[model samples]
Target: MKTQSKKAMMIGTLALMLGTALAACGSNGNNGSSADNGAANIQSANGAKGADGAAGPNGGTAAGTDATASPDLSKHVKLTWAALGDPPKDFDAVKARLNEMTNKDLNADVDFVWIGWGDLDSKYPLMLMSGQNVDMIYTAGWLDYSGNAKKGAFTELTKDMLDRYAPNAEQKLPPEAWSNATVDGKIIAVPRNFLEYQDAGLAARGDIMEKAGLTTLSNLDDVETYLAAAKEADPKVVPFNTGASVGDYPLTSFVTRKKALVSVPGLPANMLQFDPLETKPQLTSSFDDPDLLAAYPKIRDMFLKGYINKNVLNNKTPSRDAFKAGQSALAAYGDNQFRDAYNDINAAHPDWRVSFQSFSPEGPFIKLAYDSGMMAIPSASENKERALLFMDKFFSDPNYYMLMIYGIEGKHWAYTADKSQIEVPAGSDPSLYPKWQYPWGFGDWVGFNKPSTTDYPDYAKHVEYMRSAAKDNPYANFKPNIDSIKNEIAALNNVFLKYGGALAYGAVDPDDALKKAAAELKAAGYDKVKAGIQKQLDAFTPGS
Candidate 1:
């Protein structure tokens, strides 16, 4: 977020941010930050507000301003949106823009209710049952996408409605992905599209590596070398710092050689959306896998050698922040986190260099089943037409996309000499930066407006470079029917919780942790999930 308020700059920055957030998907089939968690039916933050056109059951009343019966949308419509941290700097301006656009595009008015960062899931569920009449909502598993779909918190969109009203959004998406979003054959959510893959990877400080006498880092060996160099250069800093939630990374990076670990989501042999495969309709969850067979030992070794920062296990600070502080050499994360921290690192470490790698092995990654981020129609909305129109304009209107993302161009940002770069516009106050998150719905990769009269390097090359490095996990669109194994899924998560973290974090003996978890899963119907997935895969063998 920058101080300017140009729409173009906002959109471009938004795209960059989204690309980073959704980099996992945009990069081919990986997620940059596990934070987006837009995986499979995870209701995305940017949901649909029904588009304007012919209205049917989802339409409003004639007593209101709608063409037919006017239902007094301002009175009846209540919407709730979920998000991280506080709203952006120009949040009011953005909402004003939305209200103005709503009046222009449709004849209804509405408001966006916000839910804070505090314990979202527990609170969101309460909100759902409160009968508060929320018109649209943001959801994910943590926010309960699957749970809510089952609980009937959202209204399902009829296919006819999508085609007739939201043809633009419907046409833009890849087909099978749409199929995965249906609950009992009803489209309950709007899927989020991203540019990069969502898989985990590494973020290394170039300056630290340079001092460590390493120019490139493709493996843990390089990381070790870099850490040693950093300590030698400045003993004050811990060469490595990690979150308790992410301890698995160092373990995985060491085991995989140069690749980042993958948590595929399908049955055995049939990879999930995260896998690299020509054919497969399944996903794999590496979280509980023995790949840690190697990962555990390596990470344990690092821990013993004091190669990692001493405060890692207790460090509640964000990994990206630690990197930005130059307290660590490598930050293990996805493309999403790296981007959020990238600018800061550049600013803080102007003399430093930066690069990334994955913690998974260098070869034969798993295929992930379909992953998703969603937007949903709140059962509470009365102004569906206006809401839909807003989204349509939001994605399709170049100007709106730009405005929502970058703010007013000349005031928010300026293009470089070659018109290749977007920097904070001159004379803008960095403190009052306007924040716009565009990647919420639009894909990670897109060109809002080309340079009119300049020729810098191809800014689009970064897109090309990432695309070249990507391979869609053929199973990216497949999702299994988990109704039969729903209970088991919960039980398994509990079991994994008990021993999984211990194993991944090396908090407990690896052998004991794996044994306990495997045994617990086995007794709790681990095979049931595998079989359930197998049954679906067999049904779609043609794709396999």
Candidate 2:
């Protein structure tokens, strides 16, 4: 009787393991619908829906009681985590410290894989194709999230799995974030819970703004006035140095107004403009907009009047470099870029105070939550549950998150005398302890420590301002599946690469350039791609 009882217990344990394995590998059954045959439809809406997965053998329970229950400290597990960028020289040391904590708290260790920026495009795809033993990966819209999701490269983060392993994170993440992460009604990634307002504008020399007799630069006229002052002040300095490309600053009309659908690059046929005030959103070509058209001539005038660099069409020098070298007075900048510019300029030229000016009177522009950043579990991972558990700890536990981002507290960084902020110790060699400030890619922003007072005096105020005044894109959660129009998109990109920069910089005649680009786009099946986009837009119901 004793032997029989032991045999029954062993069989039940084996069954449970088998069941868990099967559940992890099962299909999510939410492959998004494909575009209908013919002109691909393009409509404007928000959000996609995903189907939930069936409960696993352990019966999805609360935080600690699920089938993949709280990790067993007695048994050890190791996971492979891949993040973008070059590995730090002290990576092994950091990993050793990280493992010490993880082993004690979660009974697991992580083998971090750093994919350098230059190698990501090639390496990531190969890993997915070869079904490498990678567990978690840093992914983002700009980093091919849509493409990888479509290819089943990432696991479907079902509600049950989330509840079982990352209940706190599931509840902490905003609804909009989940909506953005969903593809074909299945959540394929866990987006970081960070608030970032990427309002685009310009950074200029403070002396130039004062010399231009301008207190504020909120519009194109103000920008022109500032440029003129800088030119008059110094003949050697380009008033507005716009590097080799025309850049997105020229499309301030679209960006500042939030009229453009900021989809992943190479997907849209043209700059698809929309009216945020409209009850019903519609996609229109910026090339066809009269207001947008007017900006082209103005750009041309600036180019001709010598307000902008004459060699701007193919200038390889970065605007920041030009500023450092005293070759440029003004450069296009995003909100955070201004801070960096200020720091660099202040370090180099203490007498020259650098300041930033926003073009949009509407304040900061809020990007979609998912656009902030995300980490995803690969579909090929056998240790999905362990990975999810680690993610939860990374997001919810300040110690883990801080350790991963800033490194050892006393060694890599130290608190200020008042303990209100953190900073490197005096006389410490930074190279010995590299700080990877990639919170958006690894963990929740809510867990991040407050910035040191020395870094930004008004850090708290800035956060409050962004929370209160930043405007979200009305179409923030819209996800268009453009598999059918890939060929057309490729063709459009080629044409844009050849002629778009010239048009953007006013280096070419607008009328002739626009007509020729339009003609070529049509030949490349632009209309068909537009239709397909319209179809997805029409079918989409925001937050449905």
Candidate 3:
């Protein structure tokens, strides 16, 4: 496990302590239909049903669960989930309606502590370190779930606990989900059953692309062309709303697509890369790679030409948020970021015609880590059992899960006539109640809904491609035991952050910066950290 500096720990602890009370207050409400009429009503109400005539993601039953089936729900409780993203308008009303069902069925009311994308890194560590009263928080491979689990920040969920408290999940979730959640022979989190492409791409305004006479962004060159045209078309908007702090560098996709390298999960900036197709791929550093060096000049050229924000290093706004707010012409990030950006931007400005262009549109897409998005109980949580029960309902109960993601149906969202997808309700401003995109922990392929079909058919197509084409990650189960080299890793990470962003964003001379960074990293024990990771990798099996 990694250790924090004395100064960082002190500051993080203080920040979390100060925000503990308000964190629980960041809550949203959702409404649920009664079990007796839910399935029938869903089926009869304008043909609003699932992919099949049935109601759930799978053709199981209707949206509601029988409240009386649970003999354990004798006392009412409240759960606080530390989730990502800002709550939409009417969140309070939605929360009230959602609590109505939870109160009836699980005898619990849930609150979400909204953590913005910009604040996630700093705040998440603080919450865990401070032992905040949050019952559950989002966890993933990118968020260092295994590292934190080893550090004793998360509760060790036993098989018996899962079978008893979250029976539906234990029974319905695939074996891979459980195995993915396991670290050091213990289940540390409840893994999301959904699979997605773990690749980066660009989200741009199709309307602007049309103005530029460009229809597609197939490669980095196309991205540059689009960025130039976008700026020319609208000088008021920044071409690319990217920053260095949150790893929002524009060249991320370029490196990934050009090299066809698979990123090592849980690493800083995914700096470690390897060829998955190689039977015994060796770990390599982006800093030392020739491809990264080659891309730096192109990125620097874009930066020098005023394509990116001049003060990006100090900017903390998330790239997607900047795009949605109309402050930037394009947002560059991952598949999930594209989905959220498309949903919100399309809702806010249907005329703008938002679209996503995958950096790797051909082959080499990798399967997302099964635990890429999950809900983990914090070690400090007082309501571990109740939290597990909530997970059970969120994953199993369609009505509850829908509420968590889409809010109250009529008020927040509406289903299509065919009942295969969702759409904005008539006369409702989608921007006001953008689909609740932050319930990632509850995202099960068996219960989730695809929204906004009218304005963005590409999103649906991309979803299909991800499910069908993405290959499983060869090192999905290889969680490196960094305990021995945690100090070296930390030092190397600091070296990268201090110099990597400058090189990536074109704020410094590539030649000078690269040499300086390489020297600093080597001095900081980069080789030792790499060896530590490789040692663990060599001893692990891919699908064992």
Using TM-score as the measure, the top candidate is: 3
lDDT digits (tens) for residues 1-544 of candidate 3: 0022222222121111111101110111111111111121011112123445432123333235442254476778888988764777778877888888878878888887876544555777889979889998887765667778888989988755665577666655565666778889988888766554444556778888898778888756777788898888888878987542232544544554544454455564355767665678788765777766777788788888888887666566646668878888876544444544465667688887887666665556556555766789999998898888878777666787777667789876788898866777878666565554556654444445554554345544555554455566767777766677878877776665566556656666788878887888889998888887877777777666
Question: How accurate locally is residue 257 in candidate 2, as Cα lDDT from 0 to 100?
Answer: 44
Query: How many residue pairs clash per model?
Result: 93, 15, 7
Task: List pairs with backbone clashes in candidate 3.
Answer: 28-95, 29-94, 29-95, 30-94, 30-95, 30-97, 30-98
* Predicted structure with the largest lDDT when compared to the true one: 3
Error of 2 at 76 (Å): 9.4
Candidate 2 C-alpha lDDT tens digits along 85-147: 445567677789889987887788889776533233356667876898898986665444776
Error of 3 at 359 (Å): 1.6
Task: Compute the lDDT for candidate 2.
Answer: 0.55
lDDT of 1 by residue, 226-308 (tens): 76787777778766665433212344434432332232232211112122343443434434444546566555566556666
Mark the regions of model 3 whose C-alpha exceeds 4 Å error after superposition: 1-75, 210-213, 243-247, 258-269, 333-352, 448-452
lDDT of 1 at 408: 58
Cand. 3 TM to true fold: 0.82
Candidate 3 weakest ten by summed lDDT: 21-30
* C-alpha RMSD values across all candidates: 9.4, 14.8, 8.7
User: What are the lDDT scores of the predictions, listed in order?
Assistant: 0.46, 0.55, 0.62
